[model samples]
Target: MKKFNLFKEIIITDRNVLTEAINSGKLFGIRVDGNICYEPFTLDDILIYRGTPDASLPIETIFGKNYQVLEDNDRVLIKAFSNWQEIIGFNSPRATYDDTTADGVDEFSTKEMENIGWHASEFNIKYRTLVDVLEDKCEGTLICIEQEEPYQFSGLGFIDDLADARDVLFEYCQREIQRLINEDEDYAQDNLNDDELEAAEFFKI
Candidate 1:
């Protein structure tokens, strides 16, 4: 049986924190559907399984602690499972880690951000280019952009040129991606699958 670690060592059993983690794109819950399911797990489904006797036994056995440690909070790191045997008792007959790789991480991040309502686009308008707009009015402006939906924009902003703006945006995107990845906790751990680890290592930011 393959070994998989789903989370970092920190044990988070708080319901509110778990919910916040899920909502803020920190922890991803696993959805069991026979053999195949999706990534960015569903919190409610995981919560349901966490309450079950069968799931509790395996979790306790694997973690060497009482199942109540989780407090019915379903949020966990992907690296939490040490092997397939540890997760076999889960609600799903087959628990697979298809999107735990670096590429998978990237795909998950992009889609997750979008699902949470982040809009990314090249600033374009009639006649004037994005560069023109930045150069004309945004130069020497201090601005802060919020990540959550109904984004609140504040301050004045400017860029040296279009290339600079593009780089800034790209850097911002990478930073957000890395931030999402870091939330997984196990992202930098040695316990990850070799392929997934390698993909993560090679992934830029």
Candidate 2:
């Protein structure tokens, strides 16, 4: 049981990954008051929470505080990348333009460029799943979802990138499935009476 401090900012993009996380009984989303309010949130809820703008807040408030997650045991709080600012904080640029825009050529304002640079410098990339990392399609250091015992994505628990992580987890899952199948076969053989074993052997031909 590893621990992660949910108090830090966290990002999740794929809805399916989020859903699986919730169903896995490992993660939870809590409210500001320290109560688990978001545990029942669905994929649609997360999408809406991430997409809808909070009119009550100022425009500068990039990350919406609508929904949040908490580590199941430690009660560590987690926030979603609900806006462009939060996304950029993860080293992902908001947008890019070529030299040929309809209005001739567009350029990022000095302040915008500065913000981008700052985000890259302070980026704390984290991934919810191997698939989420794969979809990112970029190579960089990131943190694994395991919070209790933290490890660098590029070291120790060592993953080259999202693609590598995806392949490794997939292979692990396949091996586990096969292991379960073998266990079932062993249990059947152990429990079967003589007549059942004879019938099973006959079918084996």
lDDT of 2 at 40: 43
Model 1: lDDT of residue 47: 17
- 135 Cα displacement, candidate 2 (Å): 17
Q: Which regions of candidate 1 are displaced past 4 Å?
A: 1-51, 55-79, 83-99, 106-205
Candidate 2 local lDDT, residue 95: 21
User: TM-score per candidate, in order?
Assistant: 0.20, 0.21
Please give the range of 10 consecutive residues that has the lowest summed lDDT in model 1: 119-128
Q: In model 2, which residue pairs have backbone atoms overlapping below 3 Å? A: 2-148, 3-147, 3-148, 3-149, 4-147, 4-148, 6-77, 28-70, 29-69
The TM-score, computed over Cα atoms with residue i paired to residue i, of candidate 2 is 0.21
lDDT of 1 by residue, 4-98 (tens): 12222223444454444334433233332211123434322321123112222434343344222343444443223333333334422221112
Which residue window of length 10 is worst by lDDT in model 2?
A: 91-100
